[model samples]
Target: MIKSKWTSEQLAWKIRRHGVEMTHLSGGSHLGAILSVADIIATLYTNVLNYDVKNPKWEGRDRFILSKGHAGASIYAALAECGFFDVEELKTHYQNGSRLSGHVSHHLPGVDFSTGSLGHGLSVAVGFAYALKKDGRKERSFVVLGDGECDEGSVWEAALFANHFRLNNLCAIVDHNHMQSLDFNENTLEIENFGEKWKTFGWNVIEIDGNNHQELKVAFKRVEEYTKDENHKPTIIIANTIKGFGIPFMENDILWHYRFPHDGWEYDCAVTALHQIKPEGVEDRYTPNSIENPVLPTEKDDINNDHTFSHTWNTTYPEQMRRVDAKSGTNEKVHNV
Candidate 1:
């Protein structure tokens, strides 16, 4: 067994806290995305995945791909907490010239693939699993995807390929937070009967409350056993997670899909909220919406409201372009989403 330095819960808390700090510092979006998938990443790093920190490229290590690469902060935090690199180096995340891009990057030590465009990561993971199975290696390839990313036809195509090859060594977990970039998933593209779609593709489907640590651990264990069977099929876990899981005000709100904690009130409040989750008794320590702050997009307005749209565009579009200083050989960051 690969014993972790910190328990899954502890790692999850750190990932959440680090996510808040990283997003605040970098003015990066996707903190909500990060929180939704934190526990899944934490559980894998803590108990499920087999890896060597000293030798990240060890051939026997299991491969992990974050298909919803926008949520890269959580995985980066996990890798740092696991000693893949100095945790302090995380401050450079999304900064110009930093290896930590806004999306997951292979330039980092532990990441096997870079994925930001979405939906293509599973294809790469399927290839990895197929190669491992053909070589008769015990190694596995795991992928974490966003529920919104499922709208991509490429994801289903990869699913078909995995089933045809019967790549039992492959496991995929979807962060089914029910929200996309601009609004709730149903309001955008309804992926109803999500698990059934995977089952139709000939995959073993396991649906669970994604934010629950114990359930995540159990789901991973089941997938592990499924991989050992001679006639095993690829498994896809439909992890029904809240869009903004940890912080109370942010939970289930589509506004956070691209909102970062700015330097003042938002940053202070987010840090305070994450700090409330104690190492000993997280449930007792934390209170939902305990801090009295302005509720954005107000109760009267759904995410489609003009205020929400304007806020998103105002916060997201300004950061899209990057400029380089030709003589200084230094890059300047205008904005990052």
Candidate 2:
């Protein structure tokens, strides 16, 4: 039986370790970005999301879209931990002819949408929420966007449309890490007054330490409650995070964004850093029911196998909360949960 109170730190460590393992095997980049957002993904899967591993197509399940699709490795780790797929399959990530790619795909069992292009997921989430509203369904949609991706004009367009319709069921989290593709976001494109910008666009904005599991849980609860009220405004969480969050040398280094760890020493350092942190526990407020033995995918063909991914809904509470860690800029201490 999965425990009710699992540590977020543990999840983050698992994500980092898994990401490193995948990178070592696949020789791919973006490990730093993926590690940075592990906690945010972990919190959502563990504490807030409503879905079943057995029935991935359940209509009542909440939806999560990773707008920053390059972080697919981290998301996949979380999904596997949440019982969406077999963890062993992660070794095939980015492998030739493998379902797991660098970007998220709709073909993945627990993935809600295929996303690689920036500025696309928020709009897709908005559309999903609008349709749910039209059908009188109580489902909610969650999206995580990269800070650098905010430069895209379509993100603002989606914000306008979401606000215009008062799609309160829609929630978006911006990973406010300062770095972008080529340079620091401040140097590349100045986005002064980020909070005010979202508020002006008609969103209920909440800023929190993205690495803190407690704060994340509180923020998620607030968003849920906010959606229940008559207020027709959508919510935006400006999650303050660090680029290259876990590995000391990689933190805030632009080179790490696209660089894979090459030296054995760097790999060893990453492993040690992960070992020092512990996972956060789930809160006592929500109790989980026992989970039955999961049934494995019968045949590879039964798997969606598309490059696209989507999530189905489940109404019952599961045994464990899905947990992952977000990156904190500092290296003084490892914060989990």
RMSD of each: 9.3, 17.6
Q: Least lDDT summed over 10 consecutive residues: which range in candidate 1?
A: 281-290
Q: Per-residue lDDT for 82-124 in model 2, tens only?
A: 6778888888989989889889987889888999899999999
TM-score per candidate, chains pooled: 0.84, 0.80
Q: Which pairs of residues collide in model 1?
A: 319-335
Model 1 lDDT per residue over 189-286, tens place:
88998988999999999999999999998999999899989578999999999977888868877778888877555665666667677475333222
Off by over 4 Å in 1: 1-3, 281-337
| Candidate 1 accuracy as TM-score | 0.84
lDDT over C-alpha atoms for residue 235 of model 1? 97
Question: Which candidate number has the best lDDT?
Answer: 1
TM-score of 2: 0.80
